[model samples]
Target: MHETVTVAHDDAAVVKMADLFDPEPATWGLRGDPYVWAALRKHLSGKDIPASLNEVLALLHAAFDELVGLDLVTEPASSVYREQYAHGGMSGGMIDLDAWRQRLIPLLTERARMRLEA
Candidate 1:
């Protein structure tokens, strides 16, 4: 459900969606998870989503491409790096964003963020 769009940048969504490749409908907690979805639906109870699925899809694609192109952004399973990566498949809890951010925030730089945002 997650209708509010907690994060503005689509890269995060794109990363989540990338897990849905090659015909697998990837599960992203609240997004694809029944329990999480129910919670989010309740969280946004009675409110309308300002954006449509296609809009979300486009944003994710853009963010994903931007991240992939090294427009200065980095992915969780960093396409650029291997040293900092956690060794596991997409289904593991390792890719869970809170975990990713906990690990990534220290490694990523303000300079990188500025560069990427620019």
Candidate 2:
């Protein structure tokens, strides 16, 4: 024979619901394979990012999606790149691949760090 048990909560606990569901923003962390950066860099070589923020974001999204579709990069990495581009800023202007490479170096480094840690 087996017995089942039930747990009960007091009304007072509900008062602290805010704490139970903390609103603090989580720290940003890389969430993908670092090697993806290398692949992206290679793919982007000699190409330029569009001057328009919208265009740049769209390009990145598409490129990342294709990489994921081809299994070249993990889905998580693509997701992280999407998030990064969204919050990167509104600044937009035609930038060569080298310039874009410099800008994304930090993100790539972080991704590498996360990969190492994992």
Candidate 3:
């Protein structure tokens, strides 16, 4: 059986999408993943929801590239080095690009499209 879902088109929906950043998603690939989440949250804060999925995706990709300092969507790298997040010794400031593209981004997009009202 397939569940029906509605995509909310309001500021509250935008807020919900932005909230997806906090509480630190469990599916992070590296130590610096939380840093990226924070950055994404900041990027999406007070932002309007795009009219089209493609537009929203483009906005998300731009934010991701800006935070990670590389165009993961276009370049598709294994990882990217970040000096700001380098404080963590284990990850060595590297954010797993594939994880963001394959996992986190999709999760965020899914949430972005979810209905706020029952």
Top candidate on lDDT is 3
lDDT of 3 by residue, 1-118 (tens): 9999998767543454476555557667877777888878887887766655676678889988777777875775688778887765778678888888888887777665652321
Please list the C-alpha lDDT of all candidates, in the order they appear. 0.31, 0.37, 0.73
TM-scores, all candidates, are 0.21, 0.34, 0.76
How far is 31's C-alpha from truth in model 1 (Å)? Answer: 22
For candidate 3, the per-residue lDDT at 98 reads: 83
The candidates, ranked best first by lDDT, are: 3, 2, 1
Model 2's number of clashes is 0
lDDT of 3 at 61: 90
User: What TM-score quantifies how close candidate 3 is to the native fold?
Assistant: 0.76
State how far residue 73 of model 2 sits from its true place (Å). 15
Error of 2 at 103 (Å): 13
Clashing residue pairs in all predictions, respectively, total: 0, 0, 0
Reference-based lDDT, residue 27, model 2: 26
The digit string of per-residue lDDT tens for model 2 on 1-118 reads: 8998977866542221122112222322232333344345555544443434454445554664555343222332222233222323332211123322333433433333333344
State residue 60's C-alpha deviation in candidate 2, in Å. 0.7
